[model samples]
Target: MTSSYGLTRLVLTDFRNYGSAQLTCDVRPVILTGPNGAGKTNILEAISFLSPGRGLRRAKLSEVTRNNEESKKPEKEQNSSLSWAWGIASTLSTPQGSWDIGTGLEIQEGKERRIVKIGGEILKSQTLLRDYVHVLWVTPQMDRLFQEGAATRRRFLDRLVYGLDSMHVTRVTRYEHYMRERSRLLKYGGADRHWFDALEARMSAEGVAISAARRQFIDHLLQAKAWTLGTFPQAELALAGQIESWLGAYSALETEEKFREVLKASRQQDRESGGVACGPHRSDFTVTYREKNRAAAFCSTGEQKALLISIVFAAARLQNLQGAGVPLMLLDEIVAHFDERRRAALFEEILSLKMQAWMTGTDIGLFTSFNNKVQYFRVENAMVHEKSVLIKM
Candidate 1:
């Protein structure tokens, strides 16, 4: 199920803690190793920002700049306040077309400006950016995902769904706007029932669609379970909330209407809370290891890590089959806590999936089991250096 990348280059100038660095690799699995605060994670964050949502850290554009501008050797007149260009290039090969597709980010003061260009022509809609690139990542922060609140897991699900369904981003975006307006109306001392009526209908349509897409993704995940479990533990996933219950018993349109009515009735309570109290927004994903018959959250740490890795590998393989390109994986310190056997299994599974995975760890020995064919790099003081992907074949 291996897939090749159409794009591969990260050029950064005057960005964040990084003084100035250019990173290039052969699209093979890469491992970045460095001490904490040495800016290894920052590189991953840069790549994450290239995608739709907030970067890996989800920090504001302003927070990404360095503190002492003079320390990194000022760029003379490069505009200290203007965080300069950061872009990714993808090499495309086709009989009718052969060129690079790129997306760049520029920040001035506190606002971020994104420009999407193909072979140098600027695009009108940012949506055009997704056609060329799709990114999926996991950070150390996500290690406790199952133990977190439902909202946290919902966010994770939305990110995964976004990779498979580009339109899902638009649906969620429109629904969010509707929610904001509805909340504003509620915040006011008085509001017309008609106000809630129109907006609630729109919200209901989008919300139900959003939930349906999520369920579809989970279902695909389950359908792939037999193959997924061969490399890792077997797991069963259950959807928890009104949307799931409605989906179990009603048709799509009926579920949408039922969700609409629920939203209408919850307005009074929502007004009191200042946020929607019930809906797909409140839904959760319950994961159970079928063999162990126990919730993922309560499973041993090693078991949980294996489960997470298994799901990610499954999604990558699915993407390949769907011609979604190999999902560019950004993993940070993924094997830090794993024992040798698990570490070897993780490496083997990654190779089996054949996606271009980028990982970070402090242990140089972590990647020793890999073949010399894997491309590798080292990070220090925000600078990246190319190293042999594997020390020996």
Candidate 2:
């Protein structure tokens, strides 16, 4: 049961536009189609929240509540008792045995909390859910990927890593908190040289380790580029980062010390600018087209879209090879750019990987080829309903 728990069931109560939503899929790809603003992306965002961090919305918990009560009146007269809830089931494996870990999300006016229970016993920390489910996603927001800052790409990279390695989250979280503390102290005038020194030392060590994990993840992803391109016929992926170039030259400990020393030396400059001078947080990826041998940023909009799909498929292949349980994929308005040939190939690759995916588009014809292999649903007004088509394929 644990082996095939990618998305067994999802229960939503007063969540977003839906008063109640009960969805079940036994680990197969799913296609969600509907007109624009039909709540297609909302389904994916709900699935994303089942994992660590914010959902695909990157929203605060309080922001996810539905306005059923609020919409009944003017914004100024609405009360703050509005709350929303959702339940997700995942598989958690331990040395002792494999068990089901179900989680719930509850949110009200300014507070959001996650509740977890394994098989039956209520557990502390939604982190326990991390043990069972690992999630990765790509949305329309990522369409202008290369044009964006490093933080977006770094976050995309981390999500990929998190799907493959759970511990990466712990490492990343710790590194971030450490950096925040160091930044706060640096902002204060009373901070001593030794205090800053020790904090930087810790940040340096964690930062290098975090960077290494990211690079290694990219290396694994690169290994699948050929196979990925052969199947998708779109774009190529190449990791670009100063730290990636520096990985083999030094050990982790040595890298940490070097980073600490560099930060110490750059303190005055960073303080003056109110920003960290250098760290893995500044790292980013470079996407390109293989046939044209050109960067994605310079490519046509259509070409960029194709390149992104190719990269996503490549990552999916890597996930399968890594035995990272079947990944739940989300694509928001990605198929509109693809020609028929590329669309068919996309379906083929997703089917071969045996992944559970959710894709959206306004044109139902875009997913007609998915018959016999994909579950099709039409989304409208926050209601996702299965569509039975009579078209002959």
Candidate 3:
């Protein structure tokens, strides 16, 4: 079976620095070399859009469109093409099959909306894209993940969980929607008790489900041998959220009941604070360097980066071992600091998993170690050109 999976074709228009761009590739690992400001990361960001949420940069949709005179024109003065200020069309492949993912911006209901088409049929919801494509990415922005806020760590964990279970996205979306509505009702004081009860019930249900997935994902990661048999250091993971802790002693139903009471009791506090205090939203994911027995926050920058790579490798391994679709890896500027041992390990993992990973770095020498195992590309002026690879050895 051809386990390699990822975009075989990608087209971008009016996105970031590129006015028009496209690339086609096979299932081999891809290496893009370019100087700073050459739009190397932009290509990775384009791939990230194939999945849910904002791209790796978390940039606003407006920020992604190329800034040109046409983009600034008045609505009536704009042409049909103007509505698509930014767009990404691509074909993503897994071992199971290939999918045609046509997604981009469109003007609907007097507002900008992202629309998706699979094989020329418009999808009712973007959530359906999850079933066909799974994307995982690491960028320089996430280099400080351990030092960053809890929200960042939570999102990182959720992305890993999403690959295994497609419904995880829907559960999270419903949980966040209810959380916001409940917060609004508490703040504005207009909703009825029945509405409050209904919203809390839904949130508790979804929150419990989210926590359960995270718990199971962590267990799989702990057991995955990738973390133990790699050049990267082993990372110890833990959840410091109330719901996660409650799962140890209380059953799922009991935890949901407990959460409902907590939400009811916290209404006044949440209202005054303008935020929910105790749901999965408040959960914090913590990491430790298992060998050193030190928190990730205390680790050196290089060590922190290694720990992240270790975790991602382990997650990919688990997905393949359990028969979940292998995720496409979009690593931006990842190998600049990698030592020889670590670099070789990363290459071995990618080849072993048969994952179509798109990796970027400024220096091509950092990647010559792969020799003939990878395809090389040169990125310049918002475009990618295929290049011949010359093995160093």
**What is the lDDT of every predicted structure here?**
0.73, 0.71, 0.85
Q: How many pairs of residues collide in model 2?
A: 0
Best by TM-score: 3
**Residue-wise lDDT of candidate 2 within 286-376, one digit each (tens)?**
6677778898788877777777777666776777777665567788888787878888888777777776777888887888787757767
Give the per-residue lDDT of model 3 (tens digit) for 91-199.
8776668888887877654578887888888888887778888889888899889998999999999999988888999999889989988988898889998888889
lDDT score of residue 133 within candidate 3: 83
How do the residues 255-285 of candidate 1 rate in per-residue lDDT, one tens digit apiece?
A: 9899888889998899999999767887898
Greater TM-score among 1 and 3 belongs to: 3
After superposition, candidate 1 runs with Cα above 4 Å error: 1-3, 71-128, 189-192, 226-231, 389-393
TM-scores of all predicted structures: 0.87, 0.85, 0.95
Ranking by TM-score: 3, 1, 2
Instruction: Predict model 3's lDDT versus the native.
Output: 0.85
Preferred candidate (lDDT higher): 2 or 3: 3
Worst 10 residues of 2 by lDDT: 70-79
Candidate 2 ranges with C-alpha deviation above 4 Å: 1-5, 70-110, 114-128, 189-192, 229-236
